[model samples]
Target: MDYSLLSQAPLFKGLTADNIVTILSTVPHRVKKFQSGSMISQSGEPVNSLIVVISGVVKGEMVDYTGRVIKIEDIPAPGALAAAFMFGDRNRFPVNVIAVSDGELLLIEKPDFLKLLMRNDIILVNFMDMISNRSQFLSEKIKFLNFKTIKGKLAHYILQKAGKDKLSLKLDKTQNDLADFFGVARPSVARALREMEEEGYIEAKGKYIKLIDKKGLADLTIE
Candidate 1:
């Protein structure tokens, strides 16, 4: 694999070709393939390394004491870090990372990984930026969960999946997944979805959802 392409990543931006190669060479890089629904990291597992997604999507989720699994976030793009829980003092992963599709990951252990960061200030800054972005996203998620109503949260979540105005995006999520994401019962999610469909804000057929009225969903956004 060409390590230079990895340097193009935000986590390695500004690093020289030589430095990138050196870091990549030092790390015991392995390509791990996981089938869909396979758990890459489970809750309470040791946070030994960082896993970078090279292909496909991964979903982070945590299960409650009642055995309810809550889907936290989705990592859809290549070069996105799959496990941010390894960043600091937390040695055990709090959430489970499951493969949303057949995917490949590049794993780098913590000690050597931190050594690489220490060797390159650019890499260190990039790491800091990634953590900062993750923090901001988590804060927003907290607000969304705590303040927004289920209807409002569902609208925003569907909008994110839709991506563009045309809403030609395919959502491979099930009603159960949507329920977990919104922290509601499956019946509640179904009710909310039905309401949205009735209002002509969205159209859902099987695994595909199209946003028919962006403004309608946008208007549902809570303060």
Candidate 2:
């Protein structure tokens, strides 16, 4: 097993590789690999272990009643999955986790992981801090999802990510990514962008868009 991967995780941050190896020695752990598009964890499934991505990407998604799949967020390498639900009374995966690329994961059963937590206070505190951060992320996501229109969602996302009147080319996302995140169809996002640009709300170039009217965007976000 690669102890270095564990050392990179936030839950194990600040610990030496030797220290991580020592901690793992007390527990029975395993490494699992997933092919691209493989189901790593299913929604509503029992959460029995703390799974950490050793490498590659993972995506969290939820399907609504209408069968529309909403992409939650992407988890990159050295990240822990379902850490916040470990000690919950009804611990379960809230979203389906799928491998975006072939990846390796290290997992420790709850009982064994809890034992390590008991032995190491740093890990325990780090785990709590991670859960707190997850709560804040969920709150922001809820606020973003509350917007009914794709245009509103797009505006809110751009404003939050930009934080200035002008948005740069470094959006770090494609149209399809934006559509998946907004839980809307790809064409819907495409149309919204086209309309926003045509309406003089934003000036769109190949990779950058300048927010021509901050008030116009903000007013649209309220809906």
Candidate 3:
């Protein structure tokens, strides 16, 4: 195992390679290998252990009543899966975790994970920060789901991304990725962007978009 890579994990942030080896030397854990396209954990599955990706990429997604797959997000190497739900009474995976590529996962059982946390102040602090940030992200995701139209969702997304200080910004995700994130067809996202531009709300060319009427964009998010 590469201690250097493990040291780069968020939970091990600020720790030296030696520090990670020293800590893990005393912690009981196991490494599991997974293939590409494998189901890691299904939605509502118990998160009884702390599972960290040692390599490759995985995605969290859910299927709606109509069987539409809504992608929550992708978790790459050194990312901990469901770190937020590793504790709490309702500790369960909220989405299906699927491996995007062959990878190895580091598994630390709950009690051992708790012991590891208690043994190191830095690990404990990092764990808490990770959980808090995920909670805030989920809150924003829920807010996005409330919008009834694809245009409305795009409006809220652009405003939030540009923030209060910037007039021009580049999109971080591609249209295909955005469609997955928005839970809509890729053509719908393209149509919505084209419509928004035609309406004088924004000037978009590829990934670059300039907000022409911030108020107009904001209004679209309201209903």
Candidate with the greatest lDDT versus the true structure: 3
lDDT of 2 by residue, 37-146 (tens): 99999999999999999998999999999999988789998998888887778799989999999989988998888888898999989998899998987787787789
Local accuracy by lDDT, each model? 0.76, 0.86, 0.92
Which whole-number lDDT from 0 to 100 does residue 204 have in model 1? Answer: 79
- Residue-by-residue lDDT tens digits, candidate 1, 119-164: 8788788888887887887786775586366778877777777666
Rank list by lDDT: 3, 2, 1
The alpha-carbon RMSD values of the candidates against the true structure, listed in the order shown, are: 7.3, 4.3, 3.2
Off by over 4 Å in 2: 27-45, 53-79, 95-105, 162-172
Q: Model 3 clash pairs?
A: none
> Could you estimate the TM-score for every candidate?
0.58, 0.70, 0.80
The digit string of per-residue lDDT tens for model 3 on 72-165 reads 7889989999998888888999899999999999999999989999989999999998999988977877787899899999999899899999
What is the TM-score of candidate 3? 0.80
Q: Which parts of model 3 have CA positions greater than 4 angstroms off?
A: 33-45, 56-76, 95-103
User: What 10-residue stretch in candidate 3 is worst by lDDT?
Assistant: 136-145
- For each candidate, how many residue pairs have backbone atoms clashing (under 3 Å)? 0, 0, 0
What TM value does model 2 have? 0.70
* Model 1 alpha-carbon drift over 4 Å, by segment: 2-8, 14-22, 77-83, 140-223
- What C-alpha lDDT does candidate 3 achieve relative to the native structure? 0.92
